[model samples]
Target: MSEEKSPFVVSASWLEDRLDDQNIRIVDAAWYLPAHNRNGRAEYEAGHIRGAVFFDQDEIADKTTGLPHSVPSPEAFAAAVGALGIAETDTIVVYDGPGLFSAPRVWWLFRIMGARKVFVLDGGLDGWKHEGRALVTVQTTPQPATFTPTYNGDAVTSFDAMRAIVDNGSVQIADARGPGRFLGTEAEPRPGMRSGHMPGALNLPAGSFASDGRLKTLAELKTLITEAGIDLDRPIVTSCGSGVTAATITLALHSLGHTDNTLYDGSWSEWGSRSDTPVTTEPTPKKDR
Candidate 1:
């Protein structure tokens, strides 16, 4: 069976055709972990899609918290996106260096902040360049626009709420880290953090949903979710190293027509770093819920 079409994603060709659309805003949302040894800003400055502005995940986050990529307040987010000349009403297209990696997080951020027409570029900049698409090294200066944000509190899971879920198993937890990290067999990329995952959290590495820097078909995603023991009928909270890749799981769920889900903003950056939260290495029994 063919995969269902996703309204939240657009093809490179689709975006290229609309590069000059007055109401469209293209964003380069590239981000990488320290272990990757790549700087998102440096890559964007070197060369990026023409007319695309860079979205600095670290700079636009809730810096008050020590956690990495923590969600910023509505006012802060509004100011940041507005300065990029992106209005909530514009048709926003976000792409990352690896196509399906960090782009989904920005897509989710816009949606939670009340942007109605945000979408991810199916083949990120990597794929675009490989296909001989156009790029420009010159920086883009956007005409500032006003953005009114309406924060969706329900879409965010608090540390306290996560603790309750871990204790009661009321919501299914999906960990987007690799199997080695999720199983505590590998050291965490972040120093001094615990290795294992949250108790009862199922491993669902973000890379599994995509191949060659592009997302897999919907049918394949459903199969992967079932194999990972995620219960689509139950509410889900997606998490990862620093709350970035977790959005890929959330995006997969949403694309599969699952709506009762949220992303843990603190993720392991907050959970594994602290001494109070519980961690486990054993695999969660499949379909126990």
Candidate 2:
């Protein structure tokens, strides 16, 4: 088999070469769950890839929505990112504290918001630091730039659209939550939420796509999805505990050359909480070792 072309991922070495390039914009898109109790901003302030401007997920998100970290409107997103000096034509490299976790969400956000040159830093800051790359502790303020957003509606799945998918089975729903959570054997990290996978959804945890903070090879990603019985050719809507890690699956699918995918923004936070939505605890057997 030939080497697969990566879609949303860029190497640390590639970014290192462009660190001084004027048009290359780097963003520290770090975010953590409330349960983790870790302050993403503090971490980013302490150390981050040189020249990276912090992208606060909470501050940049839809404040009107009650759901956690909901995707902001096209106008809202453009304004927030534009304030960080990112332009539509600039090549964006987003990374987070954890390897592949929160970075992909921002990557997905940029893509949906019509940024053409957005890419996630493979392995994130952890990999960058481990590789002895220079990092900066002092914050750098960037002059705000004007950014225009053209929303790509097809890339996102709204709650109503997900409901239709659940009922009609027109789209494959893949949950990136852990197996225990998917099986309802574990409590949700977020309190007051029900635990169980969406009915007919497949469990493929986000961690399956990374190791040691770096994304696996394309062949490995393809094998992982195929073993999970995910049809790469079919349209898939990836979900997770919230909307965060689901983007990891989206990244993986994109890396495998599967572009026909959408991310369920509300994910289990919306699906599992509703009394009317279908839920299942059926454990799927592991496909391959």
The numbered model that scores best in TM-score is 1
The TM-score obtained by model 2 is 0.94
Where in model 1 is the C-alpha error above 4 Å? none
Evaluate residue 233 in candidate 1 and report its C-alpha lDDT on the 0 to 100 scale.
85
lDDT, candidate 1, equals 0.92
Deviation in Å, model 1, residue 213 alpha carbon: 1.0
Each model's lDDT: 0.92, 0.86
TM-score per candidate, chains pooled: 0.98, 0.94
Worst 10 residues of 2 by lDDT: 280-289
Q: Write the per-residue lDDT of candidate 1 for residues 172-263, one digit (tens) a residue.
A: 99999999999999999989899999989999999998887878888888899988998888899999999999999999999989999999
Candidate 2: RMSD over Cα atoms?
Answer: 2.4
Clashing pairs in 2: none
Poorest lDDT segment (10 consecutive residues) of candidate 1: 1-10
Please write out the lDDT profile of model 2 over residues 77-192, one tens digit for every residue: 88988989998878999998767889999999988888889998888888888899998898978889888898998888998999898778788888898888999999998877
